[model samples]
Target: MKKILALVLALALVLSCASALAAKVGVSMPTKDLQRWNQDGEYMEKLLTEAGFEAELQYASNDVPTQLNQVETMIDDGCEVIVIAAIEGSSLGAALDKAAEKGVKVIAYDRLLMDNANVDYYATFDNFKVGVVQGEFVEKALDLANAAGPFTFEFTAGDPGDNNAGFFFNGAMSVLKKYIDEGKIVVTSGQTEFADVATPTWKTDVAQKRAEDILTANYADGKKIDAWVCSNDSTALGVTNALEDNYDVDTLGWPIITGQDCDIANTKNMIAGKQSMSVFKDTRTLAAQVVKMVGQILAGETVDVNDEETYNNNVKVVPSFLCDPVFANAENYKTILIDSGYYTEDQLQ
Candidate 1:
């Protein structure tokens, strides 16, 4: 009896020691409404769990105050580290300050916060590169169509509140502007003409309505619109749906559409020639890298910011890890997303 009791006690001690070595991490994501974020959250959770750490995640749903309160709770719960996909950089100042006061490390995931305060680290894709790729694809697609007689193309941007959106827009615009300036692609009616850019939430319904309005007011008036440079998959769905159901858009040769986030539906559309291409940022690789960072931080080791890149916000330089972005069209769909086990062939089909 005495020997058994001693062995039990020893086992308990080992378990306790293991748990103590594992970090307690809290993750606050911007929104769960989008498919990519959902996958990101799930992947991160699984990775953290496998690393023997506890992960507490909160969805802001684009709500700043809610995220702030959640962070405060995490601090009170004695989290050692924090990962935030901030809804808005400006509103997260107080939460970050509290984390800093507690000496807890923070990582800005996918988007850089603008507060100018010290953010420990960031993990995301090369968003600017995503835009540039989209631009090049757009120009190529247009040229392939031999889109004759100089027609005006429409521009639809993401929500202006997201800093990443601006980066994406700017990246694509860098290539698009060159053509616009040289009279290759004309800018027709959009946020510029309406005096407020198309900064709608990532809702297909809203994008569809916007496209319907454009077709009704502009196309009906004898103005022939040519291509559409949609920012992401959801917006592309909206524009495509409007064109198909409302306006018989097939007659327009399915303008050069763009998207991101290799959602199953979007991938199918790309395969079927309904959409153009999407930027494929492997969430599995991203999740693994973040888990590795957390492991190092938990083990009382410092993050190696020397090799990581830095991006400036309003006040401070944010150390960031920019992962490579892969452009996926019909050619590399199976090789990139399917074979990597990000999703199954059946899910996409």
Candidate 2:
């Protein structure tokens, strides 16, 4: 009888220890307004929970102060790991300093947290490649290699505060700049600089307003925009909305617009022949990799990185694992998004 009691107590103690050791991980997202961030946060939470860890997910609604406060709260709540997709990459240095003081591990999720030594690892898709895919889509659709005349092109990039914005802009420009210089592509608005083309907050409404302004300034003379290389789906949606409202689609025809994130609305637009293509970064795959990385960190195993030199936060070079991104259009949305269970047909419809 004493032996049985002893065994019961021992089992209870083991269970308690296991519960205590289940480290809490905090995932901080920029905003829930964007479809991509919603998918990223939920996927990360689900994967972390399934991996025997506690997940604390927070959204900042595009506010930098709110994100910093949330990080402090997570730290107070005993989060051992903090994953942050910063609203502005450079705004989290002070908050991260506190996190580092507590010996908490930090992972920059999708968006690199810039100029902070507290960041331990970065997990993101190749942002430059995302732009390349967008540029290539335009090249193929316009038959730039074989076409005869010049095409009128415009650019729309993401928030200037976001570091990835530069990468996407540069990547697309790398492909299109030569054409622009050789007179194969022309920017009627003359808004070629990244600063001029940046859309604050990656807001669809801001992008729409900018598109309206661009159309008003450049196309009022009935000059048609042949292609619009928007950095992501939200911006693309804005451009599409502007064109649909301002231009006569029957005569002017829709431009070959590029986007990223494979957003459902944008995917549907692609299917309906409104938007041209979107760069699909599989958030599920990224979340799984991050979960695995967290597990390794907790287990005291070595974390792996494919990129050691590329991502510098102005303080130190962050070790990074860059996931590959692919472009999705009407032809392969079903195979890439639907068949892979990232979304269902009903969702896209």
Candidate 3:
């Protein structure tokens, strides 16, 4: 009996030592205010912990300086790897340089870290494809391919500081510019340039105000906006709010809006027919992929990357693993969101 007890205590000691020696990984999210970021951060932390790593998760509350400081703290805490979904792509150069000096591996998560030489790999959904899907949805809904009558359209892009915002805007523009040039689509607000239509921090209220101004100035003269191609769900929600509050439902009707992130509020909007479509990137899948990459990185194995050519972070092309995105509308939200166990019906309601 004493021998058995001694063996059990020895096993416990080994387990405790293993836990103490586990490699640490830091995950920095831009904000917890957004449901998507909350999901991403939680999922990643859970997965990393399950994989036997010390996961340090931090949310920067959408502040660049705060995010930088959080990352610095992670480095100082002896994190072997740091995964960052940057608040602003270009603002992390100093923090990332410190990470490099500490010989820590940095993975740009979802948001590409710009102008930094320390970013080792990028893991995100195909942002360009996200835009393409949005653009295609608008085209098919409006019958732009069949030369439908001239329609007034507007755009609402994400923060200019986000590298993915440019990719999203450009991808959508690639599909829509031909119609604009052919005179089939007109910019009602003349806010066609990305700079003009950008939402500063993907803030819903800011987007709402900008969208309100656009509707009041352009559509107030009895003109209708056929579509508003917003980059993500937050901006889409803003446009929806402005439309419902300002414009008469009978006169202007709801424009066919496009968005990404399949956020809960936007999913509710999609069900109510207030939102046309959203691109679902599935954070669970992304978190799993990132966790796998982290495991490989920790094991000193060659990390898997499918695309080595596309994402140039101004310093070098980041090795990227691009996940596919799917579009969700009212018709399939149940299947895509609920049935898939991403969300329960009660939660959405």
| Cα distance off (Å), candidate 1, residue 83 | 0.6
lDDT of 1 by residue, 1-349 (tens): 9999999999999986687566689988878778888888888988898778998988888777998899889988988888888877667888788898999888888878776485888878888888888888887766723555465778666766567777777788877776776666777664432224455556778888888887777777445566777778878888878777655555656666788887777888889888888888888877888888888777777664433444677787777778888778888888888888887888977
Model 3 agreement with the true structure over 104-185: per-residue lDDT tens digits: 9999999999998889999999999999999999999989999667988999999998999988999999999999999899
- TM-score ranking from best to worst? 2, 3, 1
TM-score of candidate 1 against the unseen true structure = 0.88
Q: What value does the lDDT take at residue 311 in candidate 2?
A: 91
What range of 10 consecutive residues in model 1 has the weakest lDDT sum? Answer: 190-199
Q: Give per-model CA RMSD.
A: 4.4, 2.9, 3.8
lDDT of 2 by residue, 1-349 (tens): 9999999999999986586458899999999999999999998998888888999999998999999999999999999999999999999888899999999999999889998889999999999988988888898888897897599999999999898999999999988998999899999989999999999999999999999998987788788789999999999999999999877777988989999999989999999999989999999999999999988887788997899999998999999999999989999999999999989989987
**Candidate lDDT (C-alpha), each:** 0.77, 0.92, 0.92
The candidate 3 region of ten consecutive residues with least summed lDDT is 14-23
Per TM-score, the best of the predicted structures is 2
Superposition error at 88 for model 3 (Å) = 0.8
**Candidate 2 residue spans exceeding 4 A from truth:** 1-21
